[model samples]
Structures are given as C-alpha cells and as structure tokens.
Target: MTQHFTAPDRLTAKTGTQWWRDAVIYQVYPRSFADGNGDGMGDLEGVRARLPYLRDLGVDAVWLSPFYASPQADAGYDVADYRAIDPMFGTLHDADALIRDAHELGLRIIVDLVPNHSSDQHEWFKRALAEGPGSPLRARYHFRPGKGESGELPPNDWESIFGGPAWTRTADGQWYLHLFAPEQPDLNWDHPAVADEFRSILRFWLDMGVDGFRIDVAHGLVKAAGLPDIGGHDQLKLLGADVMPFFDQDGVHAIYRSWRTILDEYDGERIAVAEAWTPTVERTANYVRPDELHQAFNFQYLGAPWDAAALREVIDVSLAAMRPVGAPATWVLSNHDVTRHATRFANPSGLGTQLRTPGDRELGLRRARAATLLMLALPGSAYVYQGEELGLPDVTDLPDEVRQDPSFFRAAGQDGFRDGCRVPIPWTVEGSSYGFGSGGSWLPQPESWGKLSVEAQSGDPDSTLELYRRAIAARRAHPGLGAGSDVRWLDAPEGVLAFARDGFVCTVNLTGRLVSLPLPGRALLASGPFTVDGDRFELPGDTTVWWTV
Candidate 1:
C-alpha cells in the first residue's frame, strides 16, 4: 500500500543575520586533507593551496584540527607548544599565510585549541616535573598524592575516556590526572596562572589573524571540587549521556565567558565553538549562553538513527534548546572521532560510531545523500567534514599494525576504531596515493577510492560532489533556506517526514517502498529520481526532495 503526505501551511519567518548563525563550515583534518610538500603528511601549505576549493564549494569557514607543535601522541591534541606550529605541518609563517589566504578567499579559519590538557613534553610540564612535590609549577596541573598507605594506588576511581585509570603516577610517587592519554596531563583550571596563560594563548592566535577557535574537549576543563570518584566501571559508555565529576561541570561556563570577552575585542566577528558532549541538548545550550560560546556541535542530530521519527524528534529538541539562548543550532554528520555517515546509515541501528563490519555500500550512500539534503534544509549552520562531499565511507579494512588511534590500543575503552574514518581521501583516479601526495599518504588510501576521487566525479552531474555543489548553491540563492529558526511539520505518513520553512518545503521518505505525496510546490532538488502524476509526486524510498512553493 502506498502512503501519502499532505502539504501544510507556511510558518512565520525568522531569520539569522550573523555570519556564524547560518554559516556552512568545512572541517579539514590536516593530517589527511592534503599533502603539499610530498612528505606524505598534510601541512599548512596544503590547506593554503586548497583554500580556493573550499571557497568554490560555498562553505563560509574552515575548522581545522590541531597542527600545533606536538608529540603526535594523539594526533596533535597533546600540544607541546601552543604558540608554535609542528615542524611536520610547516612553520608559523605557513600558518599565517594559510590564514591570510583563507581570508582573501572570503573564508574564515578556525583552529583547534586543546585547553583540557597539554603534552608532558610541554615546558610547563617539564618544569613541574623537575620542581618536585609542592612546587608552584605543579599547582598549574592536577597533581595529587596517591591514596593507599604505600601510595601505590591511584588517587581515585575515575577512568580515562580512552580506557584504563585516569591517573598516572609520577617518578616522585605523586599522581597526576589525565582524562585521556598519560602523556597529556590535565590542567588545573582553578589556578589563576592556568586561566591567564590560556587567555594569552587566545590572543596570540587572534593576533595571527585566525578567525576563531574550535575548542577541543571544551567541557572537561574543570573538575568538580575535591575530584570526587564516579564509582562505576565502563564509564566511557556513559559519556554525553550522564554527568560525571570530570565533565560538563558548571565551572567550565565561566572559562568560556572569559574567552568570549577576548573574542569580542577583535574587529571581525571572531567566535568560539564548543565541542561539548553534554547529557542533553538543553545542557549543551548552556555552553552558548549569550556570554559564552557562539555555537555547540549538535551531536544529538548526528547520532540520531535513520528513522524519520527519530530525526524529527532530534531536530525539534535541538531547535527548542537553542532558541532561548539565541544561538543557532549546528548540524554535523561525521567527524574525525566517528564513523562516516555513509557507512553508518548503511548498517542497522545500535551499531555504534566505530563500525567493524562493512554494511551495504549502495544503501549507505543513498541514505547519506538523502540525509545531506534534509540537513541543508534545516535552519542552522551545517558542518561538512572533508571527503563527506565525495560520499566517502569509512575505511574498515586497515590492518591492526597500521592503527595509530590510542583508543584502539586500550581494552574496553571508548570505541577506539576511529582510525577507520581518518584514512586519507583520494584526489585523483590514479596514483600511488591517488594523488593525495607525491610521497603517498600517511594513511594508505583504498584502491576502491579511485572511483570516488574528485577527478572522477568532478564533471558528473550525478556525482555526490556535484550534488553537494548544487545544493550549496541553491541554499545560497534561495532566501527560505538557511535562515529560519524552526520547521513547520506537515502531515506525513508513518516512516516519512515532511516540514516547511519560509517559502520552502522538504519531504523525506525513510520507508523501503515508494510513497505518494501531494505536490505542494515545484521541485527544486532531489536526492534520487522521482515521478509526478498530476498534483501528486511519487517519492522513492530512502530519498529526500526540496520544493519551493
């Protein structure tokens, strides 16, 4: 039996005036985005060279993962020097040039900032270690004495998000807290010096002409007073669903409020984005409360199942949460830490973000394309991860010996298989590394990726790359898209979702069979082929269509 959905009335118009509110930001993972020096590793120069690609793709900004001076222990998250660029990624001059070039291309550059931890090799940590116990330098971090009589046990029962104990004992018998790897020690946010140093670091980057910062682990900067124990095992699974003493603490908001002050001092609309994983969308909203950050990543939307009801519910809650605070909701499907959405939607629900089994590739790509259209029709800013526009799926066949994710080495830890999503993207149809670099990529590219390369898809109107280009162009030209704060739900049958914004309507079919729906307006775009009969349109399964009334 065919289901049908009737059109609904249009809603009052609500617009987003600020650039960040309705911006389309592209995330460039520097390690795999492109390699310009033939060093097999992506560098700042590579990003500069690719600035035009981004501008032509229609994204308003680029959010780059860290390229700071690091030990490469956690892919640049463990910063050895916040003020310097890693030699592997190029010099400080390269960063300045990239930022300048990006600005000249009419794009903003947002660099990653790791405030929760610093590399053990950082000068401050080195000095703290040499100063021994009770040194003022040690006060800058969470250094505490062990609990057992012999001081052999860790201070508390807390567990690292990456697995194992959260505390690592030092040579002097004192223990330090690290929610991630032992080489990345947590900073004591309560210390005035810690706060002051971060403020200075913020200024240093702003002075470098970078647009803003995408704060890493933004919710973990402050721990509850007394560093209370969570008293539970397998705590990694509870993250973003339950509150712990170590994360989403109220004190973190004060830190962001201070950072916001620094951001406002600049000429441009410099912003701070929180990569916060809180228990609820409402709790996530707190991170962007007027005086705090400008946006928080919408994980609720990203993690929702492919079911229409589930997606609609997530959208409703997300928009409601961000409304009172006057912050635009941010939508993202995939990132460095999670499996690609194409692969995710291809499989069944409850498979988690790190997939060990490859699902139906064709099904996944179809759903992913439909999902992209639906996301673009939504009211807030959207983030497109590098390679997602190419319809790239996670590389699930990497050998164990080639894995570099720290979580992969941990037992029973947070899904450590993030390496599958970090594989280098293909640029050309043929080459040692598919034209990623002359020296080959740091991570090997799959032979299958050649068919999906930019060179292969550039001119094909049916390619995912072309679909993205057209959708982004339509969003820019259509006044109804990317402006409103809410969606008006229309009458949709089960397994289908339909909504209307100002002068625009979007309908998605999530069922396995074709469904008939009233033709509310002229079709503007579609994820797949469809048929129209008189005033009704036949929407194919696993498809989305955008319409203009």
Candidate 2:
C-alpha cells in the first residue's frame, strides 16, 4: 500500500470558490476517459495525462464520474467502498496524482459521491448477513421481516429502477430490499450509524484536499416507513415505492450541515451538486436553497420539445420556480443520460418525414451554434456534455449487441433509454480505435465522431468548437449569467426563442427555412441571415444568432 497524500495541512486561495461556479465542467467516464496501463480501460492516470486538454477548454472544473470501489454495476454507482479507489480505475496513489495535476492545470476536481447505495459485496453488508438478528452490525442497515412468518412474499410491493421486484429473498430466508439492481442494496439513511459513516466519508475526502462532491441521486437517501412493499401490494407488486418521505429525509440535511461546518472550518467552500429527479421547479429548488445544495440540475431544458414556444414556456417556468428560494438552476441541454442536442434539436425530425436524405447533419453545425447561444446566453449556469461542444452526433444506429446499459436489459427496449449517449468518445479521425488508444476501448467509439475530435475542430475558426468557445467567452464577459440577474423573454414568434438579459437580447432560429428575423437593435454577431428594423430574423435550418437591443 502506497500513500501519495496523507492529509493536507491547509487548503488555500490558489484553489478558491470561483473554481467551481464560474467553471465549465468536463465529465469523464473513467472506463471511457483514457487508458493508463494499456489494459483497454480508462483509469485515473489516464485522466491525469489529459488534464491539459480540459484547461484549454477554458473550464474552471472537471467532474470526473464515479471511480470509487464498486462492482461495476451501473458503471460504478454501486459503491463497495467509499475510501479506496477501484483497482480497475487504478490505485489511491493515482487519484492523488490526478488531484495534484488537475489543480496544477488550473482545473478544480469534483468526484461523484453515490451515497444512495453500496455494492452488496461490501464487507459490512456481508458481516450483517453472516450475523443476522442479534448482530450489532444489523443495526447499520434497514431490517424488516417478510410479508408472512414463512417469508413466502416480499414485505411490500415495490419495483426496482432496473425494472424488477425491489425485494430479493436472502438465501438464509430473510428479505433485503434493493431499489435498483439486486447487487446494489439501498443504504438505510434512517440508521444513525449510516449517517455517522457518511459524515466520516466527508471528512476523509475533505481532509485529502479534494474539492467537493456531486451527490448522486440526492432523492434516494431515505426509505418509506414500515419498509412496506410498493403501494397496496398484498401480492406480487412492482415499481417505485412510497420512499419519498424517507428518501430526502430531514436527517440528510443534518449530515450536509455537518459537512458544511467542516468545510467552513477548513476555509474551503465545498459545493454539493445534487443529482435529483424532482421535475417540478419548487421541489428541485428546495434541494439547493442556500444551506442545502449549491446547485441542483434543472433538466427541463433537456427534454423541452424543439420548438420556440415550448422552450420559452420552460424557461419561464424554471425562472419562476427556482428564483423564490434563491437556488441557482443549472440549464443542461445534454448529459450522459439524454440524446445529444445535435441529434435532438439540430436534426429536424420532421424534415426526415419529407425527404429521404436527411439534411440535419449539414445544418447541425448552425443549429448547435444557436443552441449554444441559447444556453450560454441565458441567465443560469450552463452545463455542456463531453462531446456536445464539439458537435458530436449521437450514435443513433448502434447495433443491439454493442449496447451495454442495464436499463436496456431491464426494459428490453421499452423506453429506448440512453443506449446511444453512452458510446465512447472519438479523439481522432482514423484508427482501429478512434485514437482513444493503441488497443480497443471498453465501449466502441461513435463512428460519427470521426470528424469531431477536439484536436480537429479546435484549430478551425468556423468549427462548432470555436463557436462554443465564443459563446462561453461571451458569457464570461457578461456577469449576470454566473451571478443572478432577472431574465425577460423578448416578443419573438415560433421557431425563434428570444430573450433579454439586462439589455442584451438573444434570439435563436430553430427552423429549417431561411426566415428573416427583425434586427431589433445592432447585429453584434450573426450566424444566419435576417431582416432589419424589427427583431424578426430568418433562422435557417438549425441556425442561431445573438445581439443587444
């Protein structure tokens, strides 16, 4: 065992608050980010090698997806251990090197914290199973009896997110519940010991000089009362439980407040970015109100229909919902879970209905640029996915054999969930392995990315990468986006979503035809042709433009 870092004596201003909020975050899936030992798996050392590329992107931080010890179920969400690094991702020494190098490159590092559950392989869970009812360790987790004394049925009728019964029969004849995959058991947030253990985990990482956490599934902390199966389930019941009460338990905030106190003592402002599924504005906003999370993801923009009217309605709803609680919303268009925006907005689905040959790819460059301006120019923190800035198209046609997500396995293609978005990123145009490495990758790189590497587009002035750079730079120039300022939507019609921040009026054209837009003020920047005198502008297929009124 080697220790690269014992503990930091002090953490200082060289790594400050601005390191996170104002920063652009590049998310790296450890198995797909980079391969260090040439074992065909991306590792911590691999990411350490690529720190400079992230710095070049003008981002302030990098959110490395979960690399903690896990059984690799759900790609490392099922944590077997909180303190040690997974051998597949590399050793703890590698993680220390990663933190040092990332900081040296002026990039703050925030790792994922899956506090919701742990791998069933964890030693503690094993101990609890070995010594059942009387074992003091049993108190560390939730314990409940089967529906009958004979234990013939589950205690409740609930379904797992992975698409099956939530409860599994222990070989010893008791029932333990799991909300997701059977191998990933839910943590008993109600247990005092569980809270104590998690608080200790906060100290372990903060003491290690790590920046902060992106808390995974913030809503899954607590469990429903009675440990009852899904609602009204006397028989074989399936699907989401009445876990909402226990799940974001008031006790969870107690743990967060303790962590907050510790961060203050160290003079470190550690942010907890929550991954929540709460759809309504007020519910999501409650998670980030001042003392709670610094930011929670606002996903309304991600699923918004590609229409000016639809997007504007979402923006209005988000602002009204998030502002009351002083919770700053994150406007994300794409992530590891959703289809790439270039696939959704850039490619007009209706156009395919008319013509056999799709014109979406050719116009994707302009529409993507328009989407960029719409996202960055808005009055919130904008999140860009790994390849989204480079206009990486989704691998819509991935063969069924290559899809690796368990969601697909569970639903068997019911929801058409997330298969295309999880493909490997392309780093070069031509190679046996998409320049990801000398050998093959853990997942196949999307062939559509052959012409979309950061290396290829970074140098070209007219590239989507360049346009993303400009949009980010423009946001930095305007202080209101990072900080809070009132946002007002301008009177723009369908296919054109327009808004004014302070006095800067930004408009986007989501239509295919070259519709002339009214230039309300001056044309500071124009990606497509439009008219004068009025704010009306022609938004050609997939094009966007911005200006000040």
Candidate 3:
C-alpha cells in the first residue's frame, strides 16, 4: 500500500545562487489551492500545474506548507512520514516532478519541515506504546511513570498550546508529553536516534530536487532536561505556568549547529526559514546565524498594531535585535495564523459588520494598493500570502462546525479557528464559489468574492492584481527602497508616518483628512501622481508615496 520515496534524481537543479537578497516569497496553503484529480483538497500536481501562475505573479519563491505524509490531525503538521509525501496530497514522483516544474518556471520551492513533534500514530510512537519501557522506540518520545490520581501530577505544569494538560495518561498509569495536542506527542531531541532520523529525513528531501526547507517550531525542539513545572501566567489561563525556563535551552543551539552541517554538504545555498516566535529580537537571532538558518521571521511585525507608533516600535525592535547577528531582516504584515488585515485593521466594530459593501470594497482596494507600497518599502524582503497580491480579504463566514486548525480548537469555547481566511481561492467568475472545484468546498465561499477572481481581474489595469504588478515593478526599478539599510524617520505635522531612504523621503497620510508636505526635491513617486504640485505634495486618503532620489 506504500510507494518508495527516493531522493530526487537531481539535487543541483538551480544554476544561479544568492537569489534570497531581493526575493519575494509567495506562501501557498496547499489545502485551499487548486485541487487536482477531482479531489476537494489541493495536492502536489495541482501546485505543479499552477507554477506558471506564480511565475507570472513575479514572485521569486513559493513556500508550500507541509505536504509530507500525515494523518491530517493538525492539517499535515503531524507528520507520519518525513521522507514521503502524504498520499492525500500526492506521491513521491509528484514531488520530484514538482521541483523540476517549479525550476522550469523560475521559482524556488520550500516545503515546511515539522521537526517539533510527530503524529502519535507514527511508526516509532506505535512501537513505544506497544513495548513500553522495554522497546527501543520508547526512548524516541517523552514517556514517564505516573504519580497521584490517574497521573494527574504531570512531570511539569507546562500546558499544551492546545489548552489542556501537556501530559496524557497512558493505560499503565504513565504520562506521555505533547506540547500541542494529545494526538501529537513531543519527540525526545536528546535521543541520538531522533537527531539521526531527522538528519536522514533532511537528506531524503534535499536529494529529491527540493530547493530548501522552512522549519516549523524551530525553537520548540528541545525542552528542559528534567521537564520541570512552569511557574507563572496563572492569572491569564487559570492553567499552565508561565514556564520560561523550559524553553530556548542552551542545548537547542547544539542541535541547530549539527543541522547546519547537512545544509553545508549542498554548498550551503539551500535556505532555511525558521518559524521561531521568540519575542525578543536578540533571542530569536540565535536560530539565524550564518550556519543555523538562512533567515527567521520576526513575528513582532506581524502582531503589531495598524497605527504608526506601534509599528515604529516593532521596526525598531527588529533592527535592534538583529544588529549584532549581522543577518538580513525579514518583514510581513500578514500570515496564516492571525486574523486577515481587512478584518483586523480596517473594521473598528469587529468581524461582524457590513464592511463588504461595494463602497467598502472600493475603499479596501485603495488601502490595499497603498499597503502594497508600504510592505515593499520596508528594509527587508516581504512575504505576501496567497491571494494577498490580489487584495483578497477574509470574507468567508465560517460555521463553528467546520473549523479545522488545531490552534483555535484548543482555545476552550473561544471561536479560535482561523478558517475564515483559509477559504478556497476563486479561479473562475461564473459562480459564487468561483469554480474552485467541482463540488462544495471545505469552507463556505463569501458572496463578496464573486467579482474578485483571477480570471476576471487578469487584464483589468485598475485591479489590485495589476497594482501589485506595477508596485513590484516599481520597487525593482528603484532599488533604493529594498536597499539602503539606513532609514531616517521624518517628522510631519499631521498624523503621518514618514521616512527617508537613499536621499529619498516618503510621507503617508494614514488618516482620512487631506494633508500636504513640502518636498525639498523634484517628484519621483506620488500617491496620485498628477494631483501634486512642485513644493507641497497633497496626499489623498490612506495613500503612501515613495521617492527615487
């Protein structure tokens, strides 16, 4: 019933290197993308078929979320086979073919590597459960003898991210640890077999023509040696302690150093982006040194407020955190985990509102256009989520019954599922569901997205798709925006956030009121170009203007 997964016939498929500096990475959620073979879920062949579309979008790289073998407990995060692709998504041949296809279309492919844990049903875990302490596989995971009533007193007070006891009682009155869900058991990194197995997994994919990997939960690999109880945060959760001591241990860095050696064998060009959510910039930089990982996302920017003051603080924190490491910085305003920018930043009343009216849609289109400039204008490379380039807002009203993501489910009675933004993409304009597939989707389609399909907006010059194209072209044309690491915060009288790079200053009117700012030099870029004069530049509503020199 299983097919063999041999490493790709070709490993060095890419001729050119050092493509990360100015690259724009487009992230794809495989489940919500195009579904091939008439399956409701997206698969590898479907991603291969869409390579041309990504190439046309002018993105340099495409990061495919986990396609590895899974039980779909955590939507592929609970990997059952690290070396093979999930049968639901596709076969090994599809992965090999996908790499070649993506390369042919001038795109780099990065797959998610979930190293933190594995599905309880994984082979090793099954062996551990069957043989108990006598099994060689018992050491692969964290299993301990029980104490108190039904193993109620866990080794530690650390709570699972899913909101319950991190330890689960086994049939023999022992507790097995899982930082996420009971279905996913935490692996023992100190175990030699675990490290060797992970390295072997890396070699399997790297040899398979895959470009690189995006490591999931990079910091959560190694826990405290004795598995001590967490001590704080009682007021917040009425549960697990704030256990700071158990995380980011010194031994974790040693594991990363070893992984760097595997990457080194392939000429060290294969990039690894860490999903390291360590709050402080200084602590997060440990995973992104010259050897550990090529880059690590600083989530400070993702969770920052929409206003200027908070954003500026995040910018400062990021720069300050990375100043010592000498690694390139990365930035993004949105991702798969959080609320969509449209609902979070635009709506004051919250998620349930009439914000999808025709007028609201037009206004959102304009703000999205302006946000494009700001995203690209920042110091580092930008990550644009799927359909974000087309200004797709979170419109799908997800019913509580169909929620999928595990993070929201663990939130105890809270409607924590983020399936609202994970709705299927619209490929055609003939129907309300936009012909994503032959039948109903895993998510209910928003009526508002009927007119926003790629098919309908492809040739429209004023469409957000065209605006993204123009904005990307402009950012590339003037390298100063991406270059010139130094930024000078410019002072403006009104509620404006202004900055200068490479002798060029850009001022934005974040508020609805009209305002003007005097430019010392001639015009290079303007919000609504023809509307400006020689001295003072008048900015229309929620627009940002950039300069060349």
Q: Largest TM-score belongs to which candidate?
A: 1
Candidate 2 lDDT over residue span 1-549, tens digit each: 112332232224424534344455667777776676777777888789878877666666678888888888777888899999999989888998888877666666778888887888888888988997667765666555677759778777666666667777776767777777778877787687888888788778766667778888787776656654334543212111222433544456665666566555543466778787653666677777666777777766666666777778878888787788776657787777667766665555443111112236756556666777777766656677777778876666666787666667774222444656666666777874566666677666755667887668878887777777766766666644454635776676567777776657777776666666566666655554555645444556556666755
Number of clashing pairs, model 3? 4
Model 2, TM vs. native: 0.87
- lDDT, candidate 3, 155-228, per-residue tens: 67677767777789877666888878788998999899999998888887777756678888887888877876
lDDT of candidate model 3 versus the reference = 0.71
**Candidate 1, 111-165: lDDT as tens digits:** 9999999999999999999999988989999999999888999999998888889
On a 0 to 1 TM-score scale, where does candidate 3 land against the true structure? 0.89
Which model scores highest in lDDT? 1
How many clashes would you count in candidate 2?
20
Cα error of candidate 1 at position 327, Å: 0.7
lDDT of 1 at 85: 98
TM-score per prediction, in order, is 0.96, 0.87, 0.89
